[model samples]
Target: MNRSSYPYVKTPPIFRCLIKKQQQATEELTYKPRRRRRRKVNNSDFYWWGFPIGTGGYVIIRFLLTIDWDFGSFIIFMGAVAIALISGYLLIRSYYRDFKSEPPPEYIVNKEIRKKAIDAKNKIRKRYLSRPLKDKVKKLLKGKVRTLEPLTPSATVGVSEKQFLAVLQKYFGQRVNFPNGVFSIIGTTFEYTPDIVYQDSYTGLTIDIEIDEPYAGKSKEPHHCNDNDKDRNRDDFFLKRNWVVVRFAEEQVVKYPVACAYYLSKVIYQLSGIRYEVPAEKLPSIPTWDSEESTSMARLLHRETYLKEHGLWQIRIS
Candidate 1:
């Protein structure tokens, strides 16, 4: 019935930190004395340490004549005094023997032990408590939709998908397919087929190319909403199967289909380490859209306005 029992109340890091602090407190706060060398004592070293610690030679005015306490005389006298003090310090420091280090006490070790305990506790809290919220905040801030769920291969290919497919085929001839690739998570009845599947002959990298329309045509519901977890889960599913998933906006495919293909080939080369020649030499600025934003725009039929404003990749929304 005791709540303080180790199994019921214990967090290992807290217990471990307490034990570590106890160990540190009982630890001997000392050091091995520095070993002195056995070299014969140099009389010159002792002279350097002792004889030059004076400013006697800095007495600038001769006692034989009346001296003027002018600015120039005072300046010279002060300069000589500074130089003599510096020389004395350097001479003594050069040969002075000591066993003690700069901090002079081992009490700093206790401070370090306490600091380490605090840091360890902070790390434990971060691991257990703080990180999930932090991860969620980060997810919200990174508001770009990079990919979406692939279309079902059984259905007819849409006009936008066909255009993207034709361009992808120009560079990756015979390597790309339409409605040919079928994949599913194990122990599940559901099967996902990408709109176009590209298999690299050299590196065997499988690419799942998807053209995501803002909203589902029949359901009138958002298919790739930013708040929706389905597409993210879908991408994760493909990732687990070692397939690289890439999504393009329907407009991006329709407008710059050739650029879309070039971009895809470059992505393929980057992912697979094999380059394929495409007709377009310059990299096009085919900006992607947030899934939720896409869904909203599609629902309102504000595609042109959204494209005009969020046309570049710099604008982001979660």
Candidate 2:
């Protein structure tokens, strides 16, 4: 307990020296703040200094080397001037080439005019959306009259079925069913209504035509699946009742209306057991005011020409 009473154990001098050296080494290795590297400056001053200085030095050296205005000095000066002139010419030529390559302002003006015409046509079509029977039935019942969204005709021929119907009408006339007609397949508990139905008055033959949208083939969506199943059931029900069901893809109807009508006419003739000939010109073209299916006079001439050259359009639909 008294001061200096306990004896202390001392380490060897070599070990003590080694431990001190280790401590010094550790201190030397300790982390220090890193100095940031200076970034290279991209200054325009260097460019300005180099270009004028280089050019002036070259001109001065050339002048000093030439004692008098000789042919060599004249040749060098003229060469430089020639290069500058050539470069300027090339630049101007490139600019003019680019300017000329662009379409004229009139092209843009014409495109805008065509777009306006299409919009006007669509607006006029909206006036023809009256569903006469549906409206009449609603009025007679005096019940809650329901209004459905109008099927707006597409701007393009390949996107609307109305054009296809117009084509069919041009050839078959009154035989083609359109607009207000709907085929009802009556069941004991329910009923099925399809889009279009055609019945031949002479032969007492009925054909049910159904045009389906492009997305109808996709089986992934829930509503589409349900609709497909319902359609299959309806078709089966009709087939059992001895009804002839004809289905057409909407795209086929839109894109190839002429070919589609020809096929349909052939099939109708076969099913009805009646034979008839339809002139190519008489078949309607899509975009109906196509001069009234592209004009009666144009179509007649077209038919005459087609007949003269191609002989006849014929197909066997079995």
Tens digits of lDDT, candidate 2, 11-121 = 223223433533343332222323333334346534644455456556656766776888887777666555545555654454456345655586567667767776675
Q: Compute each candidate's TM-score over C-alphas.
A: 0.50, 0.33
Candidate 1 Cα errors over 4 Å, as ranges: 1-156, 281-295, 302-318
True lDDT of residue 84, candidate 1 = 65
Clashes of 1: 1
- CA lDDT for candidate 2: 0.45
Worst 10 residues of 2 by lDDT: 1-10
lDDT of 1 by residue, 201-300 (tens): 4444566777766665545456555466777677776665556667776666656767677777766553334577876744333343466665666677
Clash pairs (backbone) in predicted model 2: 290-294, 291-294, 291-295
- Candidate 2, residue 120: Cα displacement in angstroms equals 70
The CA root-mean-square deviation of candidate 1, after full C-alpha superposition on the true structure, stands at: 18.1
